[model samples]
Target: LCYFQQGSQSHSVKHYWYTSWPDHKTPDSAQPLLQLMLDVEEDRVESPGRGPVIVHCSAGIGRTGCFIATAIGCQQLKEEGVVDALSIVCQLRVDR
Candidate 1:
């Protein structure tokens, strides 16, 4: 956790680094990644006014994309009982 100030206001930023994930490969277990996602989700839900959650990897494509897709897919599944990974990917691409 870290804090910074903009003007006279201060905010917190949390960072979760996964150093074990290889550059182009997935982790052997999804548990740690899933936990991170859940933690982020909970934080967002509990703090509606918080800033966006930023996730990144070394190259900002392979692992980063996978992590984002998984997070969005899981949220969609929870709220809609289904996951549209292709649509999510397309949306993410557009945002990028």
Candidate 2:
């Protein structure tokens, strides 16, 4: 966890890691990754005023992009009954 303070206000940031994923390869199972995402989402929901989550891997492209895309897609599916993966990936690429 990281702590930041400004005047009398203080905040902390915690990092979550997924270690089952192999180097330069996809995870053996999506279940663990999905559970991790769900845990992160639960944390976000529990902390109403928390800052946006920051997700990253070594290169901040391949796995990072997939994580973000999946999270967003899940949210979209919950709210809109569909996932626009193409658009999400395109936007993530453009933003990157």
Model 1 segments beyond 4 Å from truth?
none
Q: Best candidate per TM-score, number? A: 2
lDDT string for model 2 (42-64, tens) is: 99999988989999888887788
Scored against the true structure, residue 28 in model 2 reaches a CA lDDT of 89
Per-residue lDDT for 9-30 in model 1, tens only?
A: 9988888787667777768888
Q: lDDT per model, in order? A: 0.87, 0.90
